[model samples]
Structures are given as C-alpha cells and as structure tokens.
Target: MPDVEGHPTREEMDLRTVLNALADPLRYGVVSALLREAEGTARTCASFNLPVSKSTLTHHFRVLREAGLVRQVDRGNNRAATLRTEDLDACFPGLLDLLRANP
Candidate 1:
C-alpha cells in the first residue's frame, strides 16, 4: 500500500523507533484502540477522545507516524490515523500480538 506523506516506508521502519513511540501510555492506548478496530479501518484523531489537548494529541500522532507505527492522512479539516499493521507485522512479527495480550 502507498504510504502517507511523511511516513516512513515499510522497509524504513525501525524497531527502536517503534518501541520508543509506544512507550508512552497515551500513545499505546491510541495504538491499542486501532488494533481493536476492524482491519484497515481508519479513525479520525478526534474519535480517540484522549485526555490531552488537541495540540498534545497531535504530537502523539506525529510521534507514531514518524516511528512508522501509523499511517495518517488529512481528511478535510481533520486527520485520520490507521495502524500500520502490515508493515509492523512484516518488520516485527508477534509485536502486535504481544501488545494485545498485555492489554
């Protein structure tokens, strides 16, 4: 699949970067929510309802996107985010399963 602008390509995704991005509880929650969604589902940022302010939430998403854990695209006035499941699976097998299990 084509990557969202500014997102790392599947081959460029790195384990350390992903781990760092997921280290934050709020960021992990965002990813976990995406994991529970139907495969390929893209959710708008506002839908997450995270406790942080909009700017803070944007920072979280940027971190995830830069780490290659999510693909984010502009949807009109909002941004939509989808987990990079295929890329993550290819780069680090069982990682998502571990997250699901722990959560």
Candidate 2:
C-alpha cells in the first residue's frame, strides 16, 4: 500500500505521466467511470467490475493513483476511489471530456 499512498500531487502531475498511465484500455475505463461518478463519493475497486485478474486490477489502480487522476482513501477495512476531476481539468483542460466521449 506504500505505492498506493504515494499518489502525485496536483501540481506534480504531468501530461506524459497521465497519458502513459492511461495507455491501457482498462485504466482508461477506470478514469471514464470516475468522470461520470458522483463527486465526493469514493467507489470500491470491486464495484468497477473489470474482467481482469486481481493483480491486473491493482496495476490499473496504482497507475491511475500515481498519475494523480484518482484519489483513493482507506475507509474502515476497505479502500474507496474517486476521480480527481478538478485537478485533471485544471491541468489538461477537457481531457476528461475527451475520455468520457471516447470511452
């Protein structure tokens, strides 16, 4: 969970990192889902219903978190995730829109 806890700050995010993290379709789906999800609500990872294995899902989540596209918080015994919508909008402007439209 150390890497999970090491999410990049908004100011630290770069276009390259974000795009690289999203290179996979699974990761892209993750962001797309978050974009439409309600704000201030963190969804559990299992709720995504990805067809990948557990480790694959972890890889996707780690990439999104490290890229600063998502914020994950530990809630009781589980982890919850939410999109960093404002941060991405400020950094890349309309990137989320593109993802939502394309995904």
Candidate 3:
C-alpha cells in the first residue's frame, strides 16, 4: 500500500534521509518518544511537548515524514504521528536499536 501523503514509500526510504532527519535534536526527541511507545501507537504532534512554535513543529514533522521515519495523518484539528518503526527496521536493521542504545 502507498504511504500517507507527503511520505515516501518503504522502498524509497534512504538511510541518508533518515539520518539527516534524526540529526536534529527536536526531531530526534520526537522519534525517541514515539519509539518508546508500543508499536503502531499514534501521538498527536502537540503531545510531544516540543518547545517550538507551531510552524516550526510542522516543519519538523514534514522533515520526518519526508524521510520516511514517520507516518502522520490529520486527526480533526491535530496531526497525529507514528514512528515508522517496522519500515525502518526493514530498511536498515539495527537502526532503531542503535538509536535506543545511544539515547
């Protein structure tokens, strides 16, 4: 199946893109929190409690989505995000484990 709007397909996900998205501290924190959740759990962007403006947060999500590290969908007035853990694991084995180990 195709991915959500603005997200790359699993086969299209690139290691460089994923790494670059996680390179940002804010985005990394978002992913880290999502990683801690049960698989397939979805959290609204605001739930992350990021200390950035709405526009900035939106940009962060966009980066993650485009990198194929996240899957986001509009939920009423909020956008909810779930980490693409399965996809990430399929594309790059041990990547999530590395992130978990380092953080």
Candidate 4:
C-alpha cells in the first residue's frame, strides 16, 4: 500500500527508525494512545493529550511516521494516526511485548 503521503511503499522499515520514533516522550505518549485504541483505528491529531504547539505535534507525528512506528492518513483538514501493528510485529516480534513486560 502507498504510504500516507502517497510515497512508494518501502520494502522494509528500519529498526532504528522504530526506536528513534519512540524515543521521544511525547511520541511515546502518542504510541501509547494508539495502543489503547483498537487496531487500525485512526485517531485525530487533536486526540493527543499533550501540551505542545501545533507545529510540534506535527513534528512528533512525522517522526512516528518516518520511523514506521505509526501510519498517518490525510483526512482533509486533519490527519489521523494509527499504530503499524502488523509491520511492527513482523519487524520486531517481541519488541512491544518486552516493553509491556518491562514497563
């Protein structure tokens, strides 16, 4: 499938991208929110419970998308973000499991 931005599909997303995307506390929070929601359920940009500027929020989402930690969909006025559940599982089978098991 085409990426959110209509870019060509990447053959594979990298581990570093996943890790770097999740490294930030805010981005982590965004990931957590997605995890709380159902699989493939797209969440609005305003759904994030963070105290950041609009530009900053956009930046965080971009990081998540580039890292392949999340998939974003353009919905006219706003964008929706969801976890890359299957891709992540295939790339790092127990990554999230370990995170949940530890944290």
Candidate 5:
C-alpha cells in the first residue's frame, strides 16, 4: 500500500478475511483496480465499474470487508475501499505481489 519509508505500523488483519474476500470475481476485479495504484480509491457502482449490478457491487464490498481483502471506510457521503496489501503479504508471503503484478 503506502510505500513511505516511515509509515506507521499496521494492525495484522485476518487471513480468512482476505481469502474469502477475493473468492469472488467482482471483488477480485475491485481489488485489482485498487492495488493498481493506491488504496482508498473510490469508484461508482455502475455496471461500467464491472459487469455487475449496483446491488451486486455493494454485496461484493461487503464480502470483501468480511473476508479482509480490502478495508472500507466511510468518507463524506461515499465509502472508499483499499486493498489490504500488507495483511495479505503477511498471511501469504509474496502472494499479493504476485497476484498484483500478474500479466
């Protein structure tokens, strides 16, 4: 996530959370997009976001949060999401990097 040299230590998140979150294709796509740059990336829940319904997008976010692949926080009137790269790395070394960097 944050590549800052002195970034504050983070709390270790649950592994099952991360795995279960990414189990779905939609959530996987969201995670992929978020990790493509930075966390806390915000996007609309239109079909253009992905080949899914707005309600499905909400479900995907909920699954991702419960599973731990990404962290969702309320920002203003919107909810922002970010991939838990550090927690994922800790749970499965190099797995996130490999997945993120995949061709």
Candidate 6:
C-alpha cells in the first residue's frame, strides 16, 4: 500500500489552531497561492517559491496540516499539498474570504 499521511476532520479543526498556522507570513502565502489556484488543485512542496530552506518548508507544511488548513498526500517520492477549501468553508463561512482579504 502507498504510504499516506493523516488530516484532521472538520470537527477536529478549531479556530485557535487554524489562526496560529496562518499567523506565519510564509504559511499565509501558501494559503494565498492555494486560494488563487483552480478549485481542488494540489501542488508539490518544492513548487512553492518561498525563501525558506528545506527543513523550514517542511515545518511550515506540518503546521498547516495540523491546523487543518492544508492536506498533503504522498505520491511516490513527492508529496502534493492542497488547500482544504470546501471543508473550511463548511466549518467557518467566509473564512477563506477573510484569509484572502487580510493575508
């Protein structure tokens, strides 16, 4: 079986965790990129143009995953990340709009 990571269910996500994840400028940029992407789009971690090093990038992704704002799937040697847009919208109406506006 292919290795897979876990994500928090909508109910598992809370405002505090999500807010903490977005508090970082780099992670917020990740959210911004996802917002501009086509619906349900997922991108590889290396695709992000952030100036952070490899370790830092991994840390950022983990924070986002733990916060339930992003989902990462392992595909062979690469991992793809996607925004949990629908889930977030369902849980907190207009939250994505707020992120986009205030980001």
lDDT of each: 0.91, 0.84, 0.91, 0.77, 0.62, 0.88
Candidate 6, residues 41-103: lDDT per residue as tens digits? 999998988898988999999999888899998889878899999899998899999877875
Could you tell me every candidate's TM-score relative to the true structure?
Answer: 0.93, 0.88, 0.94, 0.84, 0.67, 0.91
In model 5, state the lDDT of residue 16: 66
Model 1 per-residue lDDT tens digits across residues 1-103:
3254779988788899999999999999999999999989999999989999999999999999999998998899999999989989999999999998887
Backbone clashes in model 2, listed as residue pairs: none
RMSD of each: 2.2, 2.5, 1.7, 2.5, 6.7, 3.1
Give me the runs in candidate 3 sitting further than 4 Å from their true place. 1-4
Answer with 4 or 6, whichever has the higher TM-score.
6
Runs in model 2 with CA error above 4 Å?
1-4
Q: Which stretches of candidate 5 lie over 4 Å from their true place?
A: 1-17, 39-48
Output the number of the TM-score-best candidate.
Answer: 3
Q: After aligning candidate 2 to the native by TM-score, how far in Å is the CA of 21 from where it should be?
A: 1.4
**How accurate locally is residue 22 in candidate 1, as Cα lDDT from 0 to 100?**
93
lDDT of 2 by residue, 3-98 (tens): 439778777898999999899888888787777778766898889999989888887888888888888988886678899888898999989889
Q: Which stretches of candidate 4 lie over 4 Å from their true place?
A: 1-10
Q: Which scores greater on TM-score, model 5 or model 6?
A: 6
Candidate 2 lDDT at 103 equals 78
Worst 10 residues of 3 by lDDT: 1-10
**In candidate 3, how many Å is residue 32 off?**
0.6
lDDT by residue (tens digit), candidate 4, 1-103: 5465732234557778678877788888788777777789999888886899999888888777877777788899999887878878877899877655443
Worst 10 residues of 4 by lDDT: 2-11
Which residue pairs in candidate 4 collide? none
